[model samples]
Target: MHICHVNLASGFSGGERQTLTLIKQQLAMGYQLTVVANPKSPFADEIRALEQCQLVLCKHYTRSHQRSITADCDVVHVHEGRAIYWALLQRLIHGVPYIVTRRIDNPLKRKWLSQLAYTRASTLVGLSSEIVRQITLRHPQANVATIPSSPVQYPVSNTDVDAIKAQFANKFLVIQAANMYAHKGFDVTIGAAKELEKHSPQVHICLLGDGKARAELEKQAQGLGNISFMGKQSAMGNWFAAADLLVHPSYSEGLGSVILEAMATGLPAVGTKAGGIPDIINHETNGYLIPSGDQGEITYAQISVNPLIPASTICSK
Candidate 1:
């Protein structure tokens, strides 16, 4: 079966990476696959690098040019919102099955057009149960299935924890690894960090990932010595290993996969009780779930960071 995957976003992020991981696993299962992505996208080259996978380029997948995607393919799997137009056309024109992985939980998306697109999908995959519930609640007949995104790489191994801890030695580290989207609640974290800094001078917060809100978030951290923005890093494993805790203040999420990674690393997490986060994190067990927006510097300390599995076991696999 030829499964054609489509995601025409200009940039690559966690969702794109997770989609590639899924496709790679499916390819390993002996399915013939092709990836249709924007040629200019960073992910395009990577997809082309993969063995036995065809890479096709579409200029910009929009509703206007949807009919052009009717080319032969057994299944078309769309990774995000941008691929929806083409995916719908394929299903309508060629009667081909299409699956969509809705990666974001946007409250603003509660509209008739959104519901129509969602209800029309052959199979809709929601990253978190909360997303599934939201869809089913709005459009009762919406076909939705909950499938969590996979980890960055399975069998996470222990690597350079001592050196990482040494980077912020004698200081409490709270790491937030998310793009600077407004929904990510960076401003709230900044407020928390500021208050925490005043109470405990040794408390340090590290903000990772890049996005539109970076500039504003940096300004919010002004005069706050404890807060540091370490931009995006290719290797988040060491950062996750090094941190004393992980904090996610997102207003919503499809499923906070990073929370799972933090848990798998045995790092205790503190996050907002919104969207599918509650599904992965059992409050006070693996992490703490706080209220959204305007919450104070609720520091969660002395919690256990999940012990890393020895590298020997993972590498052997």
Candidate 2:
């Protein structure tokens, strides 16, 4: 089938990465794949690398752009929120079937436009059960499907991994890789780190990824020697390999793909019991699950300081 993927995000994040993964898999399965993405986006650059996939550069999600790009496609698969509106427009104009992959746990605005976007789609895909529940709760008649995002196995060079290992050799490193957003729960992570600073001096918390809340989070974590912000990083494999554990304290999530990526890299995670985190982390088995918001302190304290072993090893025993 000819599948057209629409993602208008300008930056590369979990949603963009998921779009790349889906396109790659679809191409491998012999489907004719095309991507309609922003002209100056990382998603477009990566999609260009794949010779088999067709890339259509769209400066904006306009009706003319959507019509011209999706004319020959059998199915339109949208990967971002704004693209859903464009897809709905396409359905109205061209009689094309479109499916949307909603990746966030934020509630849809109670507006006619947002309501129509969800209700009129051919199918709505939620990255987690919680997201599905939220959508169905809002519009019971909406056809929602649950398909979690897949983790990409990053190819980190041995040199990079060894360098990270050497730099933080003495400290028991715990990494949290997510945009510094309020819902990402960096505040809870900072609070947990502050508490750990007084007691577990041996444990160091590294905050990866940057967003609007960086300055505020950094200020809140001041005078704490154990907590450090590493900013946005592309070489995540090195960090995962060097760290002893991963902690994701998001207040809301669609599916915690970072947790899955950490798990794939043999790092155990401590994620909050919010959104789709529970679907990825089996509490105390793969990782610990804490209550959302201010309840992370008690759960964070329960995690052992011992070096994390691979989940495969734990499963075998």
Error of 2 at 281 (Å): 1.2
Model 1: per-residue lDDT, tens digit, 1-317?
Answer: 77889888878787788878888898899988878788888888778888678777886755333443435567788876768767776666667778878776754266675555566778888888887776666666767788998777534245566776777888878888998899998888888776666555666789988899999888888899888898986677888878888888888777888888778777778888888888887876766777777445244331223223233322110
Estimate the TM-score for candidate 1.
Answer: 0.85
- For residues 231-317, write the lDDT of model 2, one tens digit per residue: 999989888888888888888888899999999989888888899999998887888877888634533432453444223322211
Error of 2 at 120 (Å): 1.8
Please list the residue runs of candidate 2 whose C-alpha ends up more than 4 Å from where it truly belongs after superposition.
66-68, 295-317
Clashes of each: 3, 0
TM-score of each: 0.85, 0.92
